[model samples]
Each structure stands twice: as C-alpha cells, then as structure tokens.
Target: MSETSELLSGLALGAFRLNGQFLQIAEGLARPAGITPAWWQVLGAVLREPLPVAGIARVMGMTRQGVQRIADLLVERGLAEYRPNPAHRRAKLLQPTAAGREAIAKIAPGHQELADRLVGELGLDQARQCLEALHRLSAALDHFTDHP
Candidate 1:
C-alpha cells in the first residue's frame, strides 16, 4: 500500500475507536437521565433556543428525518415542545422544556469532569492541537457537502 493509503487507514481506525468511546460515555451518562444518547444530543441542541428541524439536523450533521424522529421522541416524552414557525409553515421550531434543561444541566458537571480527565491524560496543549486538527478535517469534509 502507498504511504497515503496507510495513513488514511490508521486515521479511519482511530476515528472509529474514538467515536465508540464517546458513544459509550454518552450512553452511560444519558441512561440515568432516562434518555438515549441521541435524545440527549437533541436536548443539547435545543438548550440554546428553538430551532427548525432542518437547522438542528444541519448542526448535528444528521439527516432531517433522523433529527425529526428524535424531536418527536422528545416531544412525546414531554422533554421538548414544538412551536409554530412563522417563516416556514411546515417546519416547527423545537425548544427544550424545563425537564430537558434540567437533564442537561445535571449532566454538564460530569461532562466537564470527563473533558478535564481527557485533557489531563492527553496534555492540554496536545488536546487543543487535536481539536484544531479535527476542526480542520471537519471543515474540509463539509466543503464536499452542499449544505452550509
């Protein structure tokens, strides 16, 4: 294999492993709050303010249907509520409820602790560099997509 191919393969494998670890942590943290990792993500997205489904999907890098499914689940669970959108007749805006906010607030401290642990293990400077590299990679990949 060429050097570029070998490097790409290693990067792919590392990304997979890191994603697995992240999901595992998210799952564990979400379970006690009576939510799945996906639901938690939806709640986090709405924590700032109401957003259209498409907007949320774009932010989360997920399909609209996938985000809609999670939004429906959140609404059904009474964790989030949908408001009518003035600009878009069909698209409703999503916002977290008190319960949803509370759930995220509860998890924030633990999440911060986990972040601190990771930073410590990796060294703060190294972790910052890693984040910068990932951001650059994300931007490069995003350029391929039509979405902004």
Candidate 2:
C-alpha cells in the first residue's frame, strides 16, 4: 500500500478504537447518575443554552432523527423540556430541566477524575497536543467532505 493510504488507515482505526473507549468510559460515568451515555451527551449539548433538535444534531454530529428520539425521551423523563424558539415557530428549543442539571452534576466528579488520570498518563503537554491534532484532523475531514 502507499504510505499515505497506510497512514489514513491507521488514523481511522485509531480513532474508531478511541471512540469506543470513550463511550465505554462515558457509560460508566453516566450510569451512576441515572442516565445513559446518549442521554448525557444530549444533555451536555444544551447545558449552555437551549437549542432545537436539529441544532443539537448538527452540533453533535448525530442524525436528526436520532437526536429527536432522544430529545423526546428526555422530555418524557422530565430531564428536559421544549420551549418556544424566537427564531422558529415550529422548531422549539430543548433545554435541560433542574433534574437534568442535577444528573449531570452527579457525573462531574467521576468525569474530572477520569480526565485527571488521562492527563496524568499522557502528560499535560502531550494531551494538549493530541487534542489540537484531533481538532485539525476533524476540520480537514469536514473541509474535504464539504468540498467533495
């Protein structure tokens, strides 16, 4: 195989493995808080401000249908609620309820501990570099996909 082809394969494989690892860790952290990883993810997306399901899907790199299903479930479970959107009449914004914030708060200690451990293992400088490299790779892939 060509060198570039080999590098691309390696990067893809490594990312896939890392994604699985993070999901597993998220499951562990979120389980104790009475929420699944998917719930935690959707809730996290709206912690700063409410957003429509389509907006959350775009920000999360998830399918709109998938996010919509999760959002509906969150509302039913009393973790979140839909509020009127000033910009769009039909597409209401999703915001976390007080219960949702409490659940997320429950995961914070475990999240911080895991983060500290990972940073210690990788070293702060290397961790920052790894994050920057991943951001660059994601941006390049997004650009390529957009242009293509």
Give me the runs in candidate 2 sitting further than 4 Å from their true place: none
Model 2 has an lDDT value of 0.96
TM-score of each: 0.92, 0.96
Model 1 lDDT-worst window of ten: 139-148
Native-to-model Cα distance after best TM-score fit, residue 139 in candidate 2, in Å: 0.5
Candidate 1 C-alpha lDDT tens digits along 1-148: 9998999798879888988998999998888778889999888887878999999999988899999999998999899999999999899999999998888777878788999999989999999999999989778768878665
Q: In candidate 2, how many Å is residue 116 off?
A: 0.9
Predicted model with the maximum TM-score: 2
13-129, model 2: which lDDT tens digit per residue? 999999999999999999999999999999999999999999999888889999999999999999999999999999999999999999999999999999999999999999999
Report each candidate's C-alpha RMSD, comma-separated, in the order given. Answer: 1.8, 1.0
Per-residue lDDT, model 1, residue 13, is 91
